[model samples]
Target: MNIPKQRIKISLAMVMPALVSLSILMTMSIMFYIQYKNEKRSLYNNTMSLNLSSAQKMAVTIEALFSGMRQSLRASANNPAIEASAASDQKELQVIFDLMLQSSPYFNSVFWADQAGTIRVVSPVGNNLNQDRLKTEGTTEALQERKSYISAPYRTPAGRWIVLASEPIFDSSGKYHGMIGGTIYLEENNILHRIFGSGAGNGKESYSYIVDSGGRLLYHLDKSRVGENVSSNVVVKRLMGGESGMQRVMNTHGDDYLAGYASVTMNGWGIVMQTSVSSILADVDRNLEEQLRSMLFPIVLMLVIAAYTAARIAAPFTRLYKLTKSVAAGQTVSSEEFRPHWNREADQLNHIMRAAAESLAKQTLSLQQEAVTDPLTGLSNRRELERCLDSWEALRDPYAVLMLDIDHFKSVNDTYGHQTGDQVLKLVAAVMSDDVPKGAVCSRFGGEEFVILLRKHSMDEAYRLAERIRNAILISKTPYLLPLTVSIGVSLYPEHGRSREDVFQAADMALYRAKNEGRNRTIAGVKSA
Candidate 1:
């Protein structure tokens, strides 16, 4: 069969460029992976910080609301009509209670109850007026104990949530006669939003709510949850115990949230500021997409360069092969066989091939470097961690994996904005990179989470490393942002589990436990025998 030179040239052009492009494409994929890791971390931090800050601000507003209610109750207790508690004083007491209800937007009702448990007067008179309060703890405590206090939130007969604040009434002889009380109808009260300055967030997924010491919701954007028990929730439990802080928690409804909580001093009630994890990170994800698009042009240009260079190198080889094949079949060949001449084409091919080889080599090196690298933090990414896991599992090399999550990182973005949040993440990344033992692999596993592989380290050594990182994070301060802290979960390979995935899961669970137990600490995974 006769072979046409044009056909050979055409095949060479198509095949060589394609082969070269394929290799370049594989390298480009790694670059894209690196880009993805960096973008995701930035986005995650921004979202988390935003949610955190929103929660904290909402917490402060809630404390102030409770404080104002307490102050109002105190002022009302000193009224002459309330202190007198006489039958003739009912008219004046009604006027005072009515004025109190009008002035306090949150007040649902106000009433004066005698020591005998008979309600003398009530403003905006309801079924409860003239009712006995012997069964009510709030009224009994104030009337008998001669003290001022706030009560746990409860649902009234009408199914509305209300909290009572009561102060003991005393006669001129300082004898406890009865009590003057005020009620706050949580769901109907617009006063909370007024004081908190609107409990809504940047999106529908963000919201705030109030819970008493028992974890029964007093107020919520979703009214259905009101009067429901949330005591099983980790954050709620902590807040009910009078602890105030922020963390990422998964609620009983199976929703993950960045929550900030604080306890109200007067009643031990909790203010919860929370937002969905997905909604908080949405803007960051969009930003990452735009970044990828911006990088597309450069990638296209590289592919073009690879193709053109491949074609030049392939042309001369195609011509040489054809000539050799013809000669082997007893055809004569001369030095000046082609229009361009063999020598001239040989020189041109050599130069083009060298240039193409150099370009390809440089790109290959770049890809290798970036394949496991997180660009923004200059650390290994999840891809690198996966690679190390595969190698360690195959070689049966013992190691420890530490999963570290930044505590309350979302609040940073909420308070200082995303730009400052980025700075906080970078600082944390730096700390992790610097603090780990030499030869350990430190990586950002996306967002405020990071992974570190400690080679041949004992469980004790791993714990120390984790503790150091945790402590460093706690002490680290970023401008315009709060101090940072990290929770670390440690799992040893072959000890925790035989497989990489098993070890990773074990570590993750331990990390979850650490966060659940209150953050800014380290916990070791349970290893199977």
Candidate 2:
């Protein structure tokens, strides 16, 4: 009953295209039907992913900006020069304020006010800020709390919408001295606008905005909306309530939008990323009827075309889906994963995701560095030193700890001003940094004080190194012509004392005795066995 082989092959080939083409057409029809039914929901999910990513990115960056401002203020308040120079001695305070502004880009203005809330010194002056009294939320809260604070948004008497980050300055003997405040203008080209502004204005009806706890707009794509109150908006209300999510909602203007929102952890502010529903759904506007009209070729040809078309549409959606998953899971995706997919919508999605991830990575790195680095001296900060101590302690390693204090440092501040005194700190920091071996830490412990940890070094080796550091400081020259000296106290871990704190305490006691004995000498602490 079998037909001849050649005839059978030809018959089967002819029947195959008809069957495949029919199946392809049926599949296309079903896909189009499903798309028509769920297209809005599907598209909304995709756009919401993008919106959420942007909101999270903006919030992280703003939080970092706020953290940097706080760090700068804390460093300023800790400076002894700041404590020494008060009222009518703006020379020293002015110098420190200028340094604060120069070191950090987060502040639009830096100012210092005394205990009575009088703004005494302002850097880059004449910005129309009130120089007489501190009336802003940041200063008021800092003065009340007697600690560092970042205020919510408020309006200055000069009518500037701003957030003030202020730190309470304490004098050397532990009395409340004053506060240092830095202001960030909301409506201007501040860091907020510079960071999240690029998220919108693409003519795609996609935009980003920020709001404080009060639902007052801090940043908006529509310039007019900046500084306006939008608390009544559903998104703002949810954000103020500490809820983060995405939903489709109608704006006050009666336009529908898919919005994603999150709160900034450092400040009680909310960021929103949204896009118009009409614009996104437009991509699905090419009806199945129109697609069917274009598919009237021979069966074989139709099958070929259908395969090509399905691959074209399906590949990009797959990529976008995978990208969304990665971002949601907080997994960093490679740039190579975002190669141009020959589709406009997919490429744009790829670009958005990549840019956000890259920017977030950079900001995270910067924050990590800032958290462990002394801004002025560029040495390991106290936080970093403590972290290192924890690591060494866990490893149960022995090391030498040197406590150094600049002799006559206050006199330097008094004679030449804080600017020159700052030069002295930097000079001392540099001299200590120049000769430290690998696996050692040089950190600024506090004002005019530094700590160096030398791993695997005996007390003798540490004393010699400490002496070199002390001599280097004695020979170093400050910006102003003044003699310099440093007293060093060296202690060996486990030998000097059992615990890290005990070793540090022994070093401090030795340092105290050195200062008592003379102004400039190195003392190796002894522990009774």
Candidate 3:
């Protein structure tokens, strides 16, 4: 049983609006996806920038604290009473330590170590002085240097993680007498707390910390992780190398974060601040979701309008389709002089059908011309040349094909503007097009290059044609201020080879030879015959 063609046409018309709407929706979705990706990238960059700024600020603050502590120690070192008492009675040295500790909130405790590396005095009169409690290696090294030393964060014998700040004391003879030092427990310090507190206030779901020269956590908002060694972390190693930058990392808690680090002014310490990736993209996610919802509303509205317009347009086509179907079914249905609906699209479609039937032959000819012409140069394109070559090969015509290339074309494009480069190409194309013989065909192959096919031409004739084109291009003044030259290579067909591929390959080889022999010259390929 054959279904009526009219019904098929009507069914197609009904579905056309749906297809159009789907295509539009897909296009919009792709565009929206690209926009969302760009927005997410921008957000990630912003998060990195913010983290860097915060890290720098925190580093400055910590450096200032260290500076203040150094200044205080230097002032205490110059006092004759403290220096003299440090070498004598241990109780008198303890009195000096107490004074220094009370003067600064930054110091947890102050102690005096003699030249023998013995902790003679400790401030605040705490536990009994244990000689083993002092780090002999660091104390002896600091006293030997006879200058202030800021030791990297370490675990004290008392089990407290602290940084040691020590300044050497000299006797009246300028001899190294002993060392006075203070302990700064990073855990009790407010630097990490302050940085993380501000970030939290800004609704950032992340934390900040300070790491020592060895990549050991000095101060961290996560108390449990303070003193944890992070030297093996790749990002920490990068930080130790004085590279302050941003990275995405998963912390011990298994949460992904966009972390940024900056080195402190002190030699080997740095601050790292991080924020969660999700928090950074939260705004973009919300905006995209809202945009998707809004896009759906417009798409639905357009689809409804398209459906109504399709129904109105299809009503007249429905009748016309029936008449055409009757004619096709071997029933001589008279051409109905039925008038279409008053809608403009319906009337225009009816006119289109009539025009299409009458102008089919002319349309085909126009399409053929369009296929042959190069849209940019208004010359024959490669497709047209290939078709001509096929026909010429079939006839076994003896001819020559030449390929030409502009020397230093990239230099021209870079030195001059692209507009000037385009003008140069067009000028070359026009010169070559006009210089070739009447029966020969010339085309712009692609950027700064052109090809020519010469009919019934010998190798000498082809070389002469190539030389004329090259000399014409060189002598001709282009719209660009710079002069131009071309390299041309010619190969004769039937003499070179019977096949099109062989002829083109020979021409390409000749072109290479021309380029190697210095540009602005023509080279012809040797023929077998």
Worst lDDT run of 10 residues, candidate 2, spans 8-17
Best by TM-score: 3
Better of 1 and 3 by TM-score: 3
With a 3 Å backbone cut-off (N, CA, C), the pairs that clash in candidate 2 are none
lDDT of each: 0.74, 0.79, 0.75
Runs of candidate 2 exceeding 4 Å displacement:
1-31, 85-89, 136-138, 200-204, 286-529
TM-score of 2: 0.49
RMSD of 2: 24.4
Please, what is the TM-score per model?
A: 0.55, 0.49, 0.58
* Alpha-carbon deviation at 310 in model 2, angstroms: 30
- lDDT string, candidate 1, 1-529, tens digits: 9986664345666755564455456555766677667866665565556655665666666667667777777777766655564556667766777888899765678877777878877889764543654456555565666677777776655566767777777766887767777876677755664565464654347777778889998777776677789999999999878887777888778988777777777567777777777765675567667867997898678667656755676656566446544543545445454335355545554444344445555766698889989887888988888887778778889999999998887887787788887887788899988888788888999987889999899999999989988888778877664678888899998899988888999999999999999988899999876
- Give the CA lDDT, 0 to 100, for residue 373 in model 3: 78
